[model samples]
Target chain A: MNRPKKIKPWWGILPVAIFLAFWEAAARLNLMPGHLFLPPFSVVMQESYHLIASGVLIENFLSSLARVVIGFCSGAIAGLIIGGLMGWKEVLNKAFSPMISLLYPIPALGWLPLLMLWIGINEALPIAIIFICCFFPICYNTAAGIKSVDRNLIQAARTLGAADFRIMITIVLPLALPAVFTGLRLEAGMAWKVVIAAEMVAIPTGIGALLMRAESLIRVDIILVCLMVLSFMCFFFERFFLYLEDKLTGQWNQHAGY
Target chain B: MPAIELRNIRNYACHGVNLEVFSGELMVLLGPNGAGKTTLLNIIAGLAGYDGSVLFDGAPVDGVSPQKRRVGYLFQDLALFPHFAVASNIAYSLKANRWSGEKIEARVGELLDLMRINHLVSRYPHQLSGGERQRVALARALSLSPAILLLDEPLSSLDLHTSKYLRIELKQLQQRLDITTLHVTHDLGEAEEMADRIAIIHEGRIEQVGRPQEVFFYPANEKVAAFIGAPNILQCDKTRALGHGLVEVTCGGLPIVVPYDGDSIRKIALFPRDIYVSLHKPPGPKVNRFKGVISRIKDLSESIRLVVHAGNNQLLAEMPRHTFESMGLVAGQEIFLILKLAKIKVCEGGLCEQGDSK
Candidate 1:
């Protein structure tokens, strides 16, 4: 007889419920200052209900989302073109590889001092940080993906009489699109994390800025509400991105052969 | 006019590979592994660099690119693009050649019908069977209707039954289209079955080029003889020239006569089935009779292969299983074999000089 799994798939929800219960207990029992420092789960929930009712949540939500979307698009587009050129052309690779390697290792937040100096206390600063955060993964993955395209496909296309340029765009690019999308998803996650940090540090209107303001005001329930809302937003976006990817890949599978 | 005339084409894999393929005929480049058969095809297709000129329809094509040379090439590995549907795979070349969408659609449909996989139009290459893949590759090559078609072992990747079926179909298709084709294959059977002319390549060189029957019945050299699956290539010890185009030679210390030419009659190949085998030595005078023993017998699907051990030589012979069974031929049984003076081929240069064959 087969032994049943010690933790069933449904058991995955248990940890989150248990953690919220523990927090509620700790706050209600006065292990910490419930009103000023640490709020019970119920208190955070009540505060979140009010925040959503008043439309503050949606406003802060859109503010953060707009920054991430604009920054990510700019960064991903730039990365794709640069990475594609570097991967396909030797001269471009030699020219840009050295510079990219030098800059890629620095964390997205580490550029905060530089961005603040150059762009100086505006929405563009946080957007630039998100862009930098998203850029490297997309760029690196795209380049590697392009480089790893099956040489046989390229050769077959050429012999099939596809000109040099058409072969790259039609065959090589589509073949590497999956890897590029993988990079996009990875960078998206990074973009969310970095943009939040940027908003907390510099921006005044996003969810991260709300969390910073709550910290100074000692509104512990508001801080917990901000964390909960941001998690939900990021989770929703990830799921939405995945759904879009499945649709795109499903269409692609109709023609895929190799 | 010849479809392809390779004049003294020399490269590392090919050495002075001169060949003339007549229009509307299949010329097979037959060789063993690394014999440069594919390289020769590549050179003619303008996919490889070579020194000597390749003339297509009496006009030199060396300066042209592979695309401009207008030769359809079926790669040995098939090289089917994975991201295209079966119909689109065939249409790719037409699209590349700048045929209008309407023309491409018509050509693709025609090729799909000709290759007989119209049902598989929407199917991807990964979803195809081996035979389906072969047909798709051939269809993809023939879509644009180039002047010359080059096949590099088109059927090597299929099973025996599939290979046999496709071989006949490809030959028929080639005949119908009347497109000049150069086919490369390591299998002599494929060459024999499909080629109008066979060019036996060896060591990066053209050893012999002749009609299929000529190459089979009368291989130009010992290497050609061995390579053609003669199974009875013998080294001659002594040779005596007689006038009127005849020569007497000793094969494995047994006297044999051959209608020969040239100074040195060093070796010869005799087709095994052509030699008559019997248990009893005949009373009449035999011209080329040799005493040997059946060392081994293999029961094949339809034939029984017998390995006979004559003096200083081993000969392989095959006969119908029923006949072999009726004759009660057994291994280790002493036998007498007869070689007709007419059914022998004189290998101009002995295989001993070739040295590669063990």
Candidate 2:
């Protein structure tokens, strides 16, 4: 297991640096006709600094983060339980597979009107939407992971006098961890996207609300700041899940070429 | 150690199979591909369902769950846990059986030392070599101190040199442990080298069970004979009855004498090892003797294989490497050969005959 050489972190940000430089140059030279909507990179940076000084950016960012964390955790836990059961038991899989297939294709926002009538447009609304968005991919990926486990490992465990529950805990779950992590990482990105959309429609306290407020004021600089923060948050979540996955199932990933 | 007995075992992949493995003996189940060798082992370990009764030391274990059967099984793939290190893999059975932490650790240590893999305790399955992985799997299987051990083509995955080395090591370990064992393999040479008693299985049925020599030299029927590597199988061209319960069959212009039964023999299988070759004609009984020219020679490390063109038939003969070197044999040279008359197998009907002379 010879590991690949370490890559410098600054190399990854080079493209962003080049893009910002081009955008600033284009704006200063009046290269675009719709320059009002496309603010200069320096202007967006100035607006970000002003929002942070006034405490509005930190407050709104924390609100979105809290909703995502809570919604993602709850949805991920439920998905793990249901998906594990469905994968392990044929009867459960047969019973739930049709329903999952039908519901999985429905976008998270499609349930917004129905959910608003039931739970109302409150903080709970955005959290619920994020939950719906996170559940499907996590659930489906978890089940696929469990189903992909080698039957030989289970049989070997049985021959060693391991009971069904013991086998599930010691063999099945550990083997499926890599897949579970993949599901979690996918759902983490989706959680951020869904939460932002839900906040724009149903709440007024998150970064999505801040973006909507900026749009009404015709402040392109503020809108650009929100978009940059959201992009950074998504990247952060992806790296966080990747680090967790590597910590838990690094040996398996290396051995299996995952 | 307990003797394992399978009485009237019937499954999707097994017919009415009745086999008895003596206590503390390594019994090999020898057969060709898709011969239900693995199915039989699964039945014994209680991993597969069957209608017949499985008994350990005369006590029925037909209703026992696989977890409660107390059988050690080394699968053909080795099935070592990829995630767990060598020590953890061996300790898995102990942990599953609910041993205390101290006991588990001690047992794992003993197994690691016994398998001579103490240096690989922290290494994962993928980190170890093929032979090292095999040793770890063996140690894991033995951690529970099972009543009987079942090995399903355990050495089939390794290269020739490694497989040969591990075969002798496995046999020696099995002997030292004095545990009842059932080893399944498709290799006739492996069966002959390691088995105390060899059972020939074909098409989900036990064809014959006997000592290695008995099953290899005197296969009960055509299927067993063909599966046991009789390289000199010749189709008979004609047959004539000789007096005193003897019949002569002409095959490819060569006349072969076999003990007469009323049934007609269509083909005869002669083991390569049964054909004796010499440079000079010896003064002895002249039965089944012919002079042939060596058409080809194959060096097999331990033995030399010679293709002899006798009469109109090309016959294969094997001799010890030292004997072959001492005789200075070479291709295109004329030699005298003798086929042991009593060892020739007479096959009736067809190659795919379904008779079981158990």
Candidate 3:
């Protein structure tokens, strides 16, 4: 006599629902000031609704997403090119490392003033900052990935009459793809962070600008809503990138040999 | 033109060694570890860079890359591509060779059927067992229909039972494919079972090359004899020379007749299987018999190996286990031994000289 397993929806939603309920109750009971430290959850939701109605929040959200897409794409492309070049040729990697290090830790914000003067404080500045910040880790990891492809795979490919280019395309690239995807995921997250910082510095029509606007009006609820929106967007991209990574690396997981 | 030939083939590991392998012949290279068997195989495959000339059908292949050499190499590790499925892996070389799409598909299918792994076409390397993967690797190497095939310890990774089965499959496949193959293995049984000609390599050179039985019976030197399972190697200083191809050497204070050339060394060698044991202590006529003390007895299923000390020479003799058991063979018991003069081979210089067994 096999019994059906009981399902528990409460356990599934317990942590988030419990925390939100406690927050709403505490704010409504006037345990803390509702304007700043303890803004009512309902008030934050109302501000979110008002912002969406005015279309400002949607524009800013779309603009932020656009920047992330452009910046992440550019970063990934540059990383793949430079990383592959460096990984294949030891001389190139050695020559490029010092230059990469010089610019890596400059933070997207630190470059805002200079980029605004050179490329202007327009959308280019923010996208460029994101590109610069995300490029290093992606390229470095990609080079490492290429270098780490099994030597036996290369030898086997060569002995099987595969020429240099074919071996690289068929054997090297596929084996390096998993490591390359890891770099892309890491760079995607970095793109989100750096793009937000870029928007905060130079862009006036983005989620970061929304944060700035909330601060100016001293609307704590709107500020909290904007921060939460940023987090949600990051979460979405993370999950999307993870799905891509899984698709690429799932083959390696199933095939344990070499 | 020979199917393959290496003339004055001097490399870092093998110096001044020449070899010629015939088409449709299965040549086995036997050597202990560090004897450069794999190095020689790799050189023949053009996988390792060498200064010597390797010719296929009279044309020198020294300048050609291994890929262009039309030589298939099954590495000892059997490096299979993990990302590709079984069929894709086997078809990789065909695709690389620019074969037509239909031809590639047909060839891969035929090879899969030949290797008896058609059902595993879509499965990856990890999904297959060791023996299955080995067959897949072999199929992949053979995909392009190479001119020659080189196998390095093909069955070493397998267990005894699987190795036995694979050895049979490998021999059958080589004949069916009609490709000249150089199979390297340290197992003497594998050589005896598969080789048309056995080349026993020692210290990076071929010591003897002949039929398996010939190499075993007539080793070029004492080292070669011992390595090929020869049990009794004795140092016999020449005592007297009787004309007509015979020399009398006194061993164990007993005179024995040995057939030797005028420049014969004072040493003689005998394999354990060549020596016979007898129960009667009375001397036998027309057969060279010696009194020996059975020092140790070992039961080897169908046969028993006895360690007997005769004439200051410790001789190991393999006899029927039933005969030994019926005789109630025990240590410290005196026994009579008949040395087969036809089986005793004398080295030129001395008994214990070292030489390559090719």
Top candidate when judged by lDDT against the true structure: 2
Model 1, stretches more than 4 Å misplaced?
Answer: A1-42, A217-220, A251-258, B10-12, B213-229, B233-314, B317-358
- How do the residues A34-126 of candidate 1 rate in per-residue lDDT, one tens digit apiece? 345777789889999999899998798788989989999999999999999988998998898888989999999999998899999998998
Residue lDDT tens for model 1, B250-340: 8777888788876577778766666778888966877677899999987755566789888778888767677898999878999988876
lDDT of 3 by residue, B1-358 (tens): 7799987666778876678888988999997878888888777767676766888888998878867887888989898998898988998888888999999989998998999998899998888999999999999988888879889899999988999999998999999999999999987768878999998888877888888767765677766765676546566665677778887787656577788766545667676877888878655475468889999987756578899988777888987676777888889988898888876767554333442222
Q: Which candidate number has the best TM-score?
A: 2
Stretches of candidate 3 exceeding 4 Å from the true structure: A1-13, A32-36, A94-117, A255-258, B8-17, B202-204, B217-229, B232-358
Q: Rank by lDDT, highest first.
A: 2, 1, 3
Write candidate 2's Cα lDDT for B132-176 as tens digits.
999999999999888799999999899889999999999999999
Report, for every candidate in turn, its global Cα lDDT versus the true structure: 0.83, 0.87, 0.81
Model 1: residue A123 alpha-carbon error in angstroms: 1.8
Each predicted complex: what DockQ? Answer: 0.28, 0.55, 0.44
Output the lDDT of residue A52, model 1.
88
TM-score of 1: 0.75
Interface RMSD of each candidate, angstroms, one decimal: 2.1, 0.9, 1.3
